[model samples]
Target: MGNSVLVFAEVKDGRVKKVALEMLSEGKKMAEKLGGDLSAVLMGSGIESLAEQLGQYGADKVYVADNEVLKDYTCDAYAKVMADLIKANEPAIVLYGATILGKDLSPRVAARVETGLASDCTDIGLDDDGKFTATRPMFAGKAYVDLSFTDSKPNMASVRPNALPVSPPDESKKAEVVKVDVNISPDDIRTTVKEVMKTAGEKPDLTEAEVIVSGGRGMKGPENFKLIEDLADVLGATVGASRAAVDAGWRTVDDQVGQTGKVVSPNLYIACGISGAIQHLAGMSTSKYIVAVNKDSEAPIFQKADYGIVDDLLKVVPVLTEEIKKLKAEG
Candidate 1:
């Protein structure tokens, strides 16, 4: 097997996703450590122009599988193309961003290639002998485990979004693009995407947001979520909700953050009136900086927060929002 590292650069709405760039940056480091080149694969229609952006991030080579059938993501077509590429190239390492698409696609491709996959990895590295090792949270973030692939030709791992830092692009860099001809027909895909319904508002996806402001039972009711939203707006952060808030019907399930919901690692996490439960902490404990606001000083969230405010959220959030707005105005 070749020692090169291949990254699956996922695209959305004609633009390369940020996590894909993060993988490219990380993959570049891994490739160098392994004494090989870093390459990327892009699978989408009318996405040939995006290869240059991949090169700017650090891809030495880019494989483009552009076809109309591949316009929208389908389990059958994407998995077939990715698996075929792995078989043909036989890279030593394969990296994927643990986004919704990555979570769905990586396992399918690994299964087809008959390889072991480490899912939702927070960190990955190579041993002295260049063996791939991945670190993943277990048992609701209470523990972490390190895993290594055994005799797998292409050691596969899906890394969580925002787990790694993205490197700045070098515009001078360019990649050697190779076009792959997709042979799949409409009949090959069993499921069809009849329509895609998008949620309202331009809020960043919870998993990928750099900053998050979350609410819990202290939020009181659904109407009170406006405070969380206002704070998030001033900070340019996404709004998240603890399971308590969701269970209380104060927020939608999509906004829930806990063991039963989406796992997120952001640069900053603001917990307003959230008394940290183990299940709630499991999802966001990895955030770079945590600030907890709750009336109860004995709240469990204070134990994990880098900063804490012991006050009523209803009284504090509005002041916090106004203060942040003032700071922005002054700047």
Candidate 2:
């Protein structure tokens, strides 16, 4: 059989993660270039119904491992099953979404399968000889380097979430779903998920949101953060903060954005009063369009921002928000 490009179509809370859908597009492109089929491997209970949705993304086949043990995310159970599947049928390339689950699972699977794995890769492409070449940031996003597996039979790479644009879903496409049965005992599972406690909020998840409004120390204090929140509310963007603001106790740790915090790559990132240190820029530098507003014209954020406004954030934010609201109301 010709080598196939396999992707892990991860699902959470009964919905397919956007990163997985993004991978299908990349996987399809890679498979076409390599002259092979694209297969998506889905592991979880009661997810067989999602196989059809995978086909619209250009998956030639969908492999599912549905069992009660695989219902909740467990490192041991997922890794064991995936390793067994890989050993049984070798794929030329395996692409995983570099999400929380993928970051935790890809390295373990790579070690178990004895293959080269790259993490947080921003880009992956095929070499002239059908080999995989990837690019990933290094030194806390200060620089980037190329990665590849020259000797491994299967090349593995975990791409960052939101790194790729989503393609329109084409329901006209069709694919075959293959079910893989695996035996799992309680002893094989070392850990059990008692409960998952997520932050209660109506706002979208920061990492996955398309737009974000972030603030720094220049916001004066936590009370002034409402200005940032007001703009975010108008734009339907998530709220983020710089490490300076977080360390100063002006914002919660969950809202912090930097190399030490969550890595976000949104479509539009608005920086209000953030001085843009290298560490803070490490997190949101990959955003598509950056708009920075700060009183300091010499702030480093202006270097990377697509648009810059030198003004007092407190004076400028409310006016900008209302202008956007007015445009929306009229449009």
Candidate 3:
């Protein structure tokens, strides 16, 4: 690796994740600015063939550390492999997607390599001096700060999922594939993977969702959330809930959208029965469009809503769902 910008190319099932491709796009731009090559580091079992796809997204080289032990992600084994690779390659910068796996893995890798990491970053760029700079939300998404790693080589940052644009792939581009045997011994891994329990749903991931339909305490009770779910289904959208709704047992914590929960930036956000507290706004204020439905016209949510409907959600959501399905069927 020569003066490289390296991205952690994450894969799910048998395909590379969209966020990883987005990282490659951004990393490619940064690599060009720094006059360096862009590389992707991938770890999995029998995934060497997937390296070819990384080039179209703009990687100059692809490093594949394929092994049976690496098939399932174990914190110790994964971190040790990445840490060792960073020490050897010493790329100018490293990046990962701020997904669940990324959030859990990046910090450990950073600490293992004795480097600082900026997590959930919305923006990353180079300073006038060509130093790496990262910008992330703070104060419950109420504030942001630009940071740089002055003391460390190969500075690291985890880009927030969907925060960056997904660039068109260049099929003409090809990256050199370098296979490395991390050879993580059984003793090296303290944690053993047993069985994975999957969540029972076909819903899209909240962070990666293009459209989201959310509810709050105004949903009244758990059963009322079916209305929110119905609307989400009509729009092919993910379901989200305000912290108040989650705390009230109306929705699961995983569905919570706020400072204490998930941060999402979707193409469209529909808020039903939500009061629009600052904490909740912090999570979804960046969405492209916001539609709020509540009985109280003076609710704080209305202030941030691009479209507001002043009526009881119980009366409105079912009608809206039916209309949406009708329009879809008509088309």
lDDT of candidates 1 onward, in order: 0.93, 0.90, 0.89
Tell me, by TM-score, which candidate is best: 1
- Candidate order by lDDT, highest to lowest? 1, 2, 3
Prediction-by-prediction clash tally:
0, 0, 0
Q: Which stretches of candidate 3 lie over 4 Å from their true place?
A: 326-331
Model 1 global lDDT (CA atoms, 0 to 1): 0.93
**Residue pairs whose backbone atoms clash in candidate 3:** none
Give the range where candidate 3 is weakest over 10 consecutive residues by summed lDDT. 196-205
lDDT (tens digit, per residue) of candidate 2 on 166-237:
788899998899999867889999999999887877775777777999999999999999999899999999
- What tens digits encode model 3's per-residue C-alpha lDDT throughout 156-229? 99988777887898899888999887867788999988998777688768987879999998988999989988
Cα lDDT tens digits, model 1, 194-298, are 998888878779998999999998888889989999999999999999998998888889999989998999999999988899999999998889999999999
Alpha carbon lDDT of residue 18, candidate 3? 84
> What lDDT score is found at residue 205 in candidate 2?
73
Q: Ranking under TM-score, best-scoring first?
A: 1, 2, 3
Clashing pairs in 2: none
